[model samples]
Target: MVIKVERVLHMVGGGGETSYATNSRLQEKAIYRTKPILEIAVAEMYRTLLPEKMVVVDLGCSSGPNTFLVVSEVLGIVGDLCRRLEQKPPEIQFFLNDLPGNDFNNVFRSLERYEKKMEEENGGLLVPHYVVGVPGSFYGRLFPCNTVHFFHSSYCLTWLSQVPQGLGSEQGVPLNKGNFCIAENSPPQVVKAYQEQHRRDFSTFLKSRYVELSIGGGMVSTFLGIKSKHPANDELNYLYGLVAEALNAMVSQGIISENKVGTFNLPIYGASMQEVKSVIGVEGSFDVEKAESIWDPFDDSDNVLSGKNVASTLQAVMEPLISHHFGDAILHELFSLLADIITARHLLKDKCNYTVLNSNSLSSCHRRHGH
Candidate 1:
């Protein structure tokens, strides 16, 4: 069955133990690491545009403290800049966009508290900002043409708009059995399908954003990427491989059928820097100012505890898609098995670190006609 990703794909909601809100420390860390880059991007945009009303968007802004963290960071930068210049701060129109299935209600409910916190912190100098929630896929346009001034996304673009097609045969046979991602054992066709999907989706993303951004506007996006051009050689493959192993264990216990495991593939890709740069070149909409790759490998000094942390993080991100495919009954058992496999077979054995790619200060090629 083809997955309707926008209908079901989302990080686990709320503040529960298995929720994305509770398990997103890894993503939070990435945000802080990318903060300096974000600072430069925002400052440059404001100095260049100096619009009385600035439009800023955070794509794939999932629910949690991390969501609010972005808001605070942007406000702080823009507000401080205006204060130092003794200029009137632009009214910020901030949009937090994600798939329709994201926990926007949770994000909405927390807004009042966030506002109170901001007031307590920034006081009289707070930038007049309006926060709006936009629900939709980023693969398509979300705003009017030439309206938005800046965009920021973190740990989101790795997800494809949908799972790649041709993973199964016309006769209903699953091709990439026993794995849900581009693994060492994944068929060549399976790998090719993922690559094509990433190229198509990412190109469409750039094209759409190019149309939406005003002249001189840009976006900063940070996401998972493979250090090696070969997809199978990366730690990202092994990380998902552990999850596949846990699913196979369930098949052994007759909890889920082999066909069920075989048919499921994650709608995510870890593109190499070359692959990303290639897409940007082909799209020809934005100019990349700076791109850097950071190593955020898991710490192995406490492999036992770190193993559990990895399991929890993956569970939060993967639970929605897995539960939709295999039923919610097996979630606890599945992640528990994953934790054990991670501790025994992987983290305890080899010190591996996942790679995070930060691409920032991507200003649109569009500029004022005479400039």
Candidate 2:
């Protein structure tokens, strides 16, 4: 299918304003919380592969603000370790990657700021050799074989393109028409189809990573996921149902037309830990280094439910999906209503929490993959 690059870029730009602050804060949290996990991954890479220079890539790098935050933290840790060991620091090359539609302007601006900060603080001693933007899906090889040492991606893979087939109005059915709900609320076929799509997307993701990472290289990624034994109540399908319920309510109330509601689909999928490991194993290139599952309650501090935070979270989660399903015109109104509903229903006010899986906890797998 032909990708609507311009349309996607416009969508990103529209949402870019609010995301600046929210993404910054979220990146800080990710950097701090995930530091130990990253350090372990990097240490494994150094011990096993022993690359003279560490080439790190951030897939789905977006506007590069988060990329800068993560890379800076990783480099700082690496620098400290080198000092303690009395070994010279490894040369670092950071490649910031994303789709062609990502907002390059914002990314470049952020990079300039990062460069200025480095010049002032480090006197350019710790400069990355290359800070380049690569445009394409990370589900394919973006670099030559054996070129990368480490990879990091956060909160990006769960999104496929705007027109994920089998969803929306073209099918003449509600998005959740057949989803299993409350044990027996929906049809089994629907659940199978939903799951099958994620399996395919995830499989594609693994294959892509396999081609890009060197034999001994590793990747650390985190995504919204669930810890459930039953396949039906997995976080991905459950959240899909929740968003579908909200959309269906809006359709029934005439807040949005049935056709418009029909056009939209949730752009995210929350995989279970087992599901992630299985997919990675099937893809066959990397061993699980560390796997951790934790439920981070989304309190008011997360800003997902409060004044400015509410708008930012809505934009981050809804913009891509809305632009893909509905046109840009409706996004503002739709998200506004969504935020209102979330607030009025006191959903965010109560504690919006979800589970996340980290890769640092898989030490043995790291050793195995490093070999």
- Supply the TM-score for candidate 1: 0.96
lDDT of 1 by residue, 1-371 (tens): 67899999999999999999998988898899899999998998888778899999999999988998999999999998998888898999999999999999999999989989999887753799999999999999999998998999998999999999888754666678788989998889999999999999999999899889888787899978899878988998889988999999989999889988888888999998889888998888777788999987655348898778899999989999999998999999999999899989888877668888888755445533421
Model 2 residue 332 lDDT score:
63
For 1-371, candidate 2 gives per-residue lDDT tens digits of 22353345322442356554344455346556777888888877676765667888887777645667776776776776776766777778888888777777777767777868766776665534567777887666688866777788876765543333454322466544533121224345544555566778777766666666676777888776667755456544444454455566667777667665543444345667887888777766556757887676443464334534544554664566455665576666655665566555545446555577776422233356537
The 10-residue segment with the lowest total lDDT in model 1:
362-371
Write down the TM-score of every candidate. Answer: 0.96, 0.82
Q: Candidate 2: where are CA atoms >4 Å away? A: 1-11, 14-17, 20-24, 119-124, 161-172, 175-186, 229-246, 249-255, 302-308, 360-370
